[model samples]
Target chain A: MSSSANEAAARASAVSEMGRTIPTDAEVPHPEGVRWGMVVDLDRCTGCQACVVACQAENNIALNEEQRVLERRAKTWIRIERYWEGEFPNAKARFIPVLCQHCGNAPCETVCPVWATYHNNEGLNVQVYNRCIGTRFCANGCPYSVRYFNFWNPEWPEPMNNQLNPDVTVRTKGIIEKCTFCVQRINRVQVTAKTEGREIRSGEVQPACAQSCPTSALVFCDINDPESAPAQLAEAEAGRSYTLLEHFGTDPGIIYLKKVDPHAEIHEDEHAHAGAHA
Target chain B: MQEPVVADTKTSNRELLDFVFAWPAWFFAVGGALNGLLVAAFVVVILMLMFGLQFLGYSHPVYWGFLIVNFVFWIGVSHAGIMVSAILRLTQAEWRRPVTRAAEVLTIFSLLTAVQFPLIHSGRPWRTMYWTFPYDWNRGAWPNPRSPLVWDPSAIFTYLTSTILFVYVALLPDLALARDRAPNPVSRAIYGVLAMGFRGTTRQWRIQTVAGLLLSAIILPIFVSVHSIVSWDFAVTSVPGWHNTIFAPYFVIGAVHSGVSAVVTVMIVMRYAFGLKRFITRDHIDSLARLLIVVATVWLFFFLLDFFFGLYGTEPAEVDTWQRRLVEPPWVVIAITFIICAYIIPVPMWMFRAIRRNFFWMFVTTILVNVGMWLERYMVVVPALERKSGLTFTYGDYAPSLSEFILVAASFALVILGFLTFSKLLPIMPAADIKEGQILADRIRVGRANVPAAMRE
Candidate 1:
């Protein structure tokens, strides 16, 4: 083999060995000190659910049929939750995207009997599908309700079956699954960077949801990397940026920028009037 | 202390051994029905394994359902054994003699039944060995010690093993009795092997008594720890209604309440079914009822404390969970039923001596306590998951499916069937223990009445 190829192979082996040696305790950081995170700017969100569709296709998620939704058993890794401000006449629609926050102190990580779910050094809350015994304890432990269990084996009919993502595993029934922040894509980027003997560049590791976002609301980054644009954005927008369920002490990787509401007081007054009139 | 008037040793031995040696018609009828339900449950479990957990009514947000509720209920029922046998044995309560073996048998069967629900409820029941077994089958990955699910099996199995030993150590003399009275050579050999050559010598009796006492002391902590660990399965979680500090004591007390009530139910059934009326008298029922009044009241106190702590926190998510349990339609009904049946009606009724001693009323009340306790566990498990967090959009309600119902029914059938099968093999009421009690029986004159008493060793 060529000298550079040999170097790449050695580096890859070393990285694998490092991964194997890393303590299972989530408090430990990655050797590379990389913590993947996201900053969602609520101001730019349109609640169009493009990211949700993109995530489903990229992650080999089961197609949610009408019956599944009606039964309230649908699996949507990234969901846009809509809320209404004020009454019907003066009603204003608001949307916030919810996904696995991949917390530094994830509640879901501790409850799995088989270590089916854990926080990797990269700060990703990883769910090992094959290892899961489906106690659903992790799902109950999660405050965000982001973890989803496969009630039934996923089915994709006809041509859709061919579209399954080769990069992701089609999770079997009885195990839990959730957004991995598209770890497959992250791995690809890492491998590509390692092969060429260089560090991964900022903006190169976009998850499917962030990649498909039309308004650039979702920005994936290594939050621990000061050079990352999303990290810088979160730092700059500190006044508006907040994590969902801040009181939970989960210390989530996802930082959300609050939606700028100019008519906040007016909406409150209208809501009060509507309540009184009713 | 009031002791029931003891019957002659020969009569007690013959009467207790009757069910063991002869197969009563009702045994066949009830055992057959229970086996049939168990078969149906086995088929459902097979279907679930073939298909998926979709057979159950589990939806998003509400992952646990009737299976977990039944698991907790049966675990609570298993507590009857140690509560009656070990505690009474240690305290030297004479009335505990006839009830001890039956309670221990119930514990073993119910625990055997209880451990299956988590396995059956899992998405991959076959793969659960990796989680339940202590060995690191998957490379270097041992079962997570941090998880309460790991603690559950450890506590439960320890309790199961110790309980079996407790029952066995106490059963040696009885086993020897069965051996001497074996109907056939084959039966004689089986009993002979189980009896371990106990010839009822003074040394053997002394050793047996000492072993039983040692085991009782050893199992006391296990008895408390088992339910506490089970409670930690919920307490360790962030779920609003479940994450209370009072869960350990609350769960332990509640388990004893349900468990003791189950013993009362079983003793009453044994009285009729096995013709054990002489051994299991109204006085035993009266004592158990008096015990129930205290257990049920203490359980109520813990229940109220759990409720008060939930409200006192004033956390919105916690408050919302409480509101859902109290104000919500179906949950409110369940809460009310749980309260009235578990404490309100039975506790007060138990206060009246006439009610406590009446077999029929005691039977009805004890069954009601178990029903209420079952609903109590249901209230704890389901409502918390329904209002899990302040994320109202993600909140969803759970209903157990037909499959879940079948499996739960099957669990009850499994325990009953096991107990019945055991009854045929061994004396349901310990013969040797009863003989010893009869030896110690005495009376003392008090005022115009002759009060029942026991001779001190």
Candidate 2:
């Protein structure tokens, strides 16, 4: 079908999603119960950093060199924070891939003076790069520490430049950047589905992190769609699933299934350990 | 008893105006040195903008560091002028005459210096105007009013305008005096324009006095609000050491504490610089010192109040932050310095009658107080930032780069350069106000106790 024909179908579906209210602007108002979310099964994650690499490659994020990491300036849209369970013979390593929570009551959203970052209709936290003046107030407001500021101009060597994704804009120096849940991929799928005259199916749009997860530990889906894989997993693991920093009332979009360790009693004294206990 | 403030009108005019008309060799040397440093700082800042803030040692978790500390420090320094001038003017303090102009000028210059930090701290300084200004463009955007950073530009701009007006209105009679006694027609013409047709008539004086009083009332609130808003820049953030209810009053009182101390320091500097010992007398310094003591005590109370609240608060983050500031390495030294310099050493030193009256002691204590205040701002900004939510594996650390040091040094030099330039162009001391104050003092001398008599309008 032609592009205009695709646009017409998309608008019709969008209007149908919004219960047949006349679409007011170019962008369609998101239907109710359309919160896009993730469910990370910690029991299955093997501490491998495949998701990190995949995210960097897909998003055109800057290389995280040793020096940058040492300076704490490494730009990782999604990263694995490892925690040691115990010492000596009983030592164990656990991994949690931390990313932007995209909270319903986001602290970062409210503090951005320029309105550079805000929650979109589809529960996506959107950041407008050009409008950001790099006050970094949002970074401070964020409990997850997922947001990263661009301290220096991003550069890519000649051959490396060829690997850059055309879909994603490589952000310049002196602005904040963070995980977008691969909004580009979401849009791509949306455009394709709209052109095909159908609703986005469950598990249709996967973020880089979810697609590259070797053990299927990370799952992304429309939580509002009860039949979606994430929704089914989240419901099945309801007893085990919990959000990060639930005390902050952030209402994070990501849910994590508790790591089932038989040796949980061994590390009870080490309260500093980043676990379900924390 | 009603002595003229300028002992000899001709000599005083020549002495004050000579600093402007004739540039002594030492004046050029000092000014040149300061300007040279400022030029280097300007270059460093520009390079940072072109390259990145990494050149200035900013990183994750500690995104706000040196520039923010300097911003708060300079803003605190500016608080003294309005506190001394506006409060004293409202209370009808007779001794406020010789000190008011210097205090008000310090406010103007320090504010000029302080306002630059927000721009410098901005990752994209070039785009700051777009964020700050209120013009409708294609973006259909305005700054989020909820953010204290947004409140900052409004408060700072209002304060700046009010201060400039306050200083100018108060300078009218002095400007007219300078015009009549100007060395040449060119100097006379310039002063004439500045004087704005003020012939020192009854109506002009009436308007000037009433206007100055009214401006003082207007400026006093902005003076209090500006620093409070600056404090809110931190308080509004969820950072543990910040996000306190006491920040507004705490910041206001701290500003006054440092500001009044700065006035004492400047008074001493002016006393020697222009040989104005007769006008800026021991009595004036003593009174200011007494005021300083009261300010210090109040500051000490707030300091403990902040600490007590931090300790009392159940939040683990707040407790951890207090520990970092009070118990951790390197931070303990800073905390100690802040206590000693801002309170411990100065409070007792300012209490002594001889110390307050003595120019050397007053200068030393005041400088020490300012040093402590600077450290206090550092303590407030860095310690809170150094340790955030604790979820991140690596704790952030910050040490200002060489460029940051150069920029800080240049900020001080710029303030001095501005003051020096101002001193030459205008009277640093308000001669007419002092004479009028003296005349008021001489009125109603009932018995040995010469009561401060009221002036007729």
The candidate scoring highest on TM-score is 1
Candidates' C-alpha lDDT? 0.89, 0.83
TM-score, chain A only, candidate 2, equals 0.86
The list of candidate 2 runs beyond 4 A from truth reads A1-31, A265-278, B1-22, B443-457
Q: Which structure among the candidates has the greatest DockQ?
A: 1
B2-75, model 2: which lDDT tens digit per residue? 33343555555555555556666777898899999999998998898888787777777688888889999888
Cα error, candidate 1, residue A253 (Å): 0.3
Docking class of 2: acceptable
C-alpha RMSD by candidate, in order = 4.9, 4.8
Q: Score residue A20 of candidate 2 by CA lDDT.
A: 37
Clashes of each: 0, 1
Q: Positional deviation of A236 in candidate 2, in angstroms?
A: 2.6
Residue pairs with clashing backbones, model 1: none
lDDT of 2 by residue, A1-278 (tens): 67985686688677657543222233323445478889999999997999999999999999889999988899898989897766868777878888998787788887887878877757788888978889888887887888899998888889999999999989989899999999999999999999999999888999999999999999998777888878898898786788886777788889898777676566455533433652
Candidate 1 lDDT by residue in tens digits, A1-278: 67975675566456557544224322344535789999999999999999999999999999899999988889999999887875889777889899999988888878888888887768898888878888899999999899898988898999999999999999988889999999999999999999999999999999999999999999999999988889999888887788887777888999998776686555556534322111
